[model samples]
Target: MINRDLIEVFSDIAREKNVERSELATILEELFLYVIEKEYGDSSNCSCIVNLDKGEIEIYSEKTIVKEVDDYKVEITLEEAIGKEPDAEGDLDVGDVFVEVIDPRIFGRRLVTTAKQFFAQRLRDIERNYIYEDYINRVGEIVIGAVHQIQGGNVFINIDKTELRMPRNEQILAERYRRGDTIRAVIKSVEFTSKGPDIVISRSDNHFLYKLFEMEVPEIEDGIIDITAIARHPGSRAKIIVKSNDRRIDPVGACVGMRGSRIQAIVRELNNEKIDIINSSEQAEILVSRALSPAKPVQLFIDDDKNYCIALFEDENLDAAIGKNGMNVNLASKVTE
Candidate 1:
């Protein structure tokens, strides 16, 4: 009855945590062995088998029959051995192997409590591993989650029963997140920590913008358009260079969508941050000029050896080219590079 109740409780928790049945069995076996070792001082001769389907756990201890027991963990006296199995009295002799079935109840209430704690911790570890493995493969992909916690300018988002962290640096400065607010970001990185997996998500990353474009534009996802480079000041402005594999499709127009619907959606998601999509070019001058949109340079002189360009812009366009805090020219340089 104890075994049934224990198995039922643990099975429910494991299933809730999405732990595999096989993994739960392994954890159960390990838990029993741990308890056995703690009680007997040694579990080397002990084996635990778990049948989750039957809700049964069997523990066995292998010991050698001896005339006198010195180490009770591995040796049992013949008198004691026969006492356990009277039918085999004639066959049982000194040095013969005795198999003893252990009742888990014998471990007492104290040990059972300890076992529960151990099982809970094991489930937590398994949950951490599952979160790590799932998110590690999803780096650079966008995830939408609800804000669950806020501490020290860090946001904790809950999605699919897992919590993701967005640190202050990864969050958009202009955005304000509140509890229960739905937020979207890209999986920036996954790191293993002693407490658990530290799943760091980001909204300020350049890849966030790239992924937004990918989500909004089917041509980009379909391989019709390739985003060549991205430079972002996050919450402010971003520039992306795109190349069209199919000559018939206009990469910029496809990304813009009909009546600016696609780009508008992305802009709204990003808190109205401006985005400039430039067509990629093999020629450095053409690419740089396109990168500096809304402020065309009068002339551009490229120095291939120095890997630099000198742009001559009209006085009226100089302020626009440089942008607020020189962000425009810096992004242009980054995208062109």
Candidate 2:
């Protein structure tokens, strides 16, 4: 009855933690071994079995039958061995191995408390491993979650019962998060930590903008249009260079969608960040010229050896070419580079 009750309690916790039944059984076996080790100072001669089907746990201790018991944990007197199994009175002799069954009740309440602690910790470790394995393969994928906490400029989002962290540096500067607010971000990294997997999400990452474009534009997802390069100022502005495999389809137009619907959706998701989609070109001068959009350069001097381009713009267009804080020129450089 005690064994059944114990298994029931553990199984309930295991279900809540999403731990596999087989894993729970393995943990139960180890937990009992830990308890035995604490009680006897050693568990090398002990073995534990957990039967989930029957909700039973069986513990067995191997002891050597001797003329007299020296170490009670590993050795037992012949008389005691015979007393445990009367049917093997003649078969059991000195120097023979005697197997003794341990009663769960013998562990008492104190040991049960210890086992609970061990079991809880094992479940936590299993949960941590599960979270790590799940998110590691999902890096760079977009996840929409509710903001669960905001502390020290970091946002904690909850998605499918898992909490993901978005550090201040990874979040858009213009975005404000409150508890229960819906948020979307890309899984930037998954790192193992002592507490659990450190799943860092990002909204300001270049890949986040790429993923947003991919989601908004079916052409990008279907490989009809490929985004070759991307540069972002996060909540301010972003630029992407795209190429169309099928000449009939214009990459920039496809990304923009009909009446600017697709690009508008993405822009709204990103808190109205400006996005410039430039069609990729094979010619260096053409590509650089397209990258510096909204400001046409009068002449561009290319230094192929240094991988540099010096653009000469009209005096009035210089400010637009450079953009606020040189954001335009910096993004153009990134795209061309």
Candidate 3:
């Protein structure tokens, strides 16, 4: 039977995809039998088994032997049944039987054509979901993959089995990734497109900064530290507010790591983007002050109706606090909020 070759094909596919051998065998067998049942109409009396170790498959048709053939479809004559299997009876258990009645020309040329089309369509559906599941689970998590190609300034990354696209708007202005270069980014979203699933990755996403901290600082992963807020200017500068859930734990010191090694790695990944890790406070004034780190603020007054906080700073701290083109103020607003 072609079933033997089918097992081999499944094995190769499993190896390429790095899936478990048993899982691949089960999927192939289930799909193959489903195709056969769809073709034959009734699978209640038919059984299909796949032997992964031997790379073989077999199909069996179960029937009962009777003295006189009453129904040609479901019953076989006693004389013919005995010739194939002696001691077969109508009431006794004669077990399952198979005959090489399946025409290869029909199975290969007709049924298999239909089967291949069905399998291909089903596989595309599965792969689409596979891509969606992989990316959806990574929302707010950072990933590193190679930049394989580009289309209209949209970078395409080869992430595992799927290709992810980071559009120009989602990319950091100060960062550029050439073909074959590795890029670390955040999984902004996973959306469904007409063709399939679309993995929307981003370098400018604030989630990227959060994920970097999560990866760099072991305390965050262990839940000993918590990130209260994150605001970023992509390649320029970013601010993160963290607090220690456990009083004994030093959130900033732990995130900075010994000799500033952890934060340095994160900075290198961000193309030398400056990151300010500060302690978080429930008080809006204190939080806003910390959000606008590196600059000394004289006063912070929150406007209730406008939802804006007017901050007064010394002239020297004004430029440093507002940043070029008010980038720092914008980030501070986001993190403080």
Alpha-carbon runs more than 4 Å astray in model 1 = 1-3
Tens digit per residue, CA lDDT, model 2, 1-337: 3458778889999999989999999999999899989888999999998889998888999999989778999999999888889999989888899999988788789777998899989988998899999999999999999999999988999998889999999999988888999998999999999879999999999999999899999888999999999999998999999999999999999999899999999999999999999999999999999999889999999999999999999999999999999999999999889
- For model 1, residues 1-337, the per-residue Cα lDDT tens digits are 2458888888898888888999999999999899998887889999999998888999999999988888888999999988999999999989999999888888889667988899999999998998889889998999999999999889999998788999999988999899999999999999989989889999999889988888989888888899999999988999999999999999999999999999999999999999999999998988989999889999999999999999999999999999999999999999888
Error of 1 at 243 (Å): 1.3
Deviation of model 2 at 233, angstroms: 0.8
Candidate 3: residue pairs that collide: none
Better of 1 and 2 by TM-score: 2
**TM-score, every prediction:** 0.92, 0.95, 0.69
- Residue pairs in collision within model 2: none
What lDDT is obtained when candidate 3 is compared to the true structure? Answer: 0.77
lDDT (10s digit) by residue, model 3, range 1-337 = 5546755765675575556666665666666657657767765665666678877666666666566667544567656765665544443433334232232234566656665665566567667877787778877777889999989989999977588889998998898779999988888988888788888888888877788888989889888899988888888988888999999888989989999999999999889999888888878888888888778799989976787898999998999898889988898898877
Residue 260 of model 2, lDDT score: 98
- lDDT of model 2 at position 95: 89
lDDT of 1 at 195: 89
Model 3 segments more than 4 A misplaced: 1-121, 304-306
Q: Candidate order by TM-score, highest to lowest?
A: 2, 1, 3
Leading candidate by lDDT: 2
Candidates ranked by lDDT, best first? 2, 1, 3
Q: How far does residue 167 in candidate 2 sit from its true spot (Å)? A: 0.7
